[model samples]
Target: MKLPHDWFHADSEDKEMYGKELNLEMLSGHFLFSKNIEVYAHRNDATDDILCRHIDAEDLYTVVHLTWSMRPEIDNKHPTVEFHGSYDEFLQYNSKFFN
Candidate 1:
């Protein structure tokens, strides 16, 4: 398998680690970091319009679509660091960014 650009291959002397692929460069200015998360987002009934705008915008890599819910009862109210790269860099991270 193709490991991500920032990770090294496992070897006999290596200790196993749990992690996932993320566009690290995309997180260059952000403090948000996570792994093994299956994110789901739905458009607010205007998905088509938003998608069209993104398709036309030149910076497609950073364009992301988000739904309104994190769980069946909870909704994501504000934009976060992972979504915009630097959305939560200023928040006090408990060091989970490295784990």
Candidate 2:
């Protein structure tokens, strides 16, 4: 098992705020700081997607497809998050994005 270090840690405040903005009722600010959320893997390519698991929610895994806004003048905040029920589902669904 990989232990979380500085690299594994995310911006808790931003994540919490994002969760609230998305109306993720289960993912509270406190929950963001807890050990329940684990970001296991990431695709550091063009997609820049992350694979994380919500340990508290029956180990529910999700792939967060981060869309960075290059033109902040036009789009202030980037939105849109997709969720999958299982790891297999997520992988199979996103096969095209990966090798």
Candidate 3:
């Protein structure tokens, strides 16, 4: 999926310093499929940790935290709850949190 051109502009500096592109192959190995929505786990500049991007049927996006490894337990501090709206919303929310 293609992201907006300005999507990472705000965090470009942090991205340049610490962000790693999402590993689609590795992410696929970690998540189980569900019918309603698709989840993507990718590396981001959140303390150099991972983030999850969720896409619904209409293509709207929601982002949340994901487990660092392929383990059953998730980090409760971060929670599995999704927030933000679109890719742009995800970036905005993260820009504040990360900064």
Candidate 4:
């Protein structure tokens, strides 16, 4: 999937406020492979309760759901979130992960 070069660029203040909570670079990397991507934000704190869904090349019929979490710091050793299954199994566990 082709992503806009500026897709990960956020204003300094926006980055300072939410960049640590959700790494836009990592998130964009994951979604680069997605097709028909959709994102929803929580009314209260959009950064804290982000929900995204998309269909990847490996599973055209299944939509993979991803939930983002806030990271205490920028640590590549620890991922900000976790996901289960191969692309194909996303459907089987979709309901469990996503509402």
- Please provide TM-scores, in order, for all candidate models, with all chains considered together: 0.19, 0.46, 0.39, 0.26
Per-residue error at 73 for model 3, in Å?
2.3
Model 2, span 1-99: residue lDDT tens: 332221133356655543443333233332233345555555545654556677778746666654443322222223334554565666555664443
The lDDT of each candidate is 0.24, 0.47, 0.40, 0.34
Local distance difference test, candidate 3: 0.40
For residues 30-98, write the lDDT of model 1, one tens digit per residue.
Answer: 322332222222123343101111223233212133332332222232223223322132111212332
Pairs in clash, predicted candidate 2? none
Better of 1 and 2 by lDDT: 2
Candidate 2's displacement at residue 8, Å, is 12
Tens digit per residue, CA lDDT, model 4, 14-99:
43444334443343344323235333222122224332334343433222222344432333323333343343353344345443
Better of 1 and 2 by TM-score: 2
The 10-residue segment of model 4 with minimum total lDDT is: 1-10
Pairwise TM-score winner, candidates 1 and 4: 4
On lDDT, the leading prediction is: 2
What is candidate 3's lDDT per residue for 1-99, written digit by digit as tens? 443332332244543332222232123323322323333333334432433444433445544444444343432333243454666666666566555
Whole-model alpha-carbon lDDT for candidate 2: 0.47
What's the alpha carbon RMSD for model 4?
10.4
lDDT of model 2, residue 61: 69
For model 2, how big is the CA root-mean-square deviation? 8.4
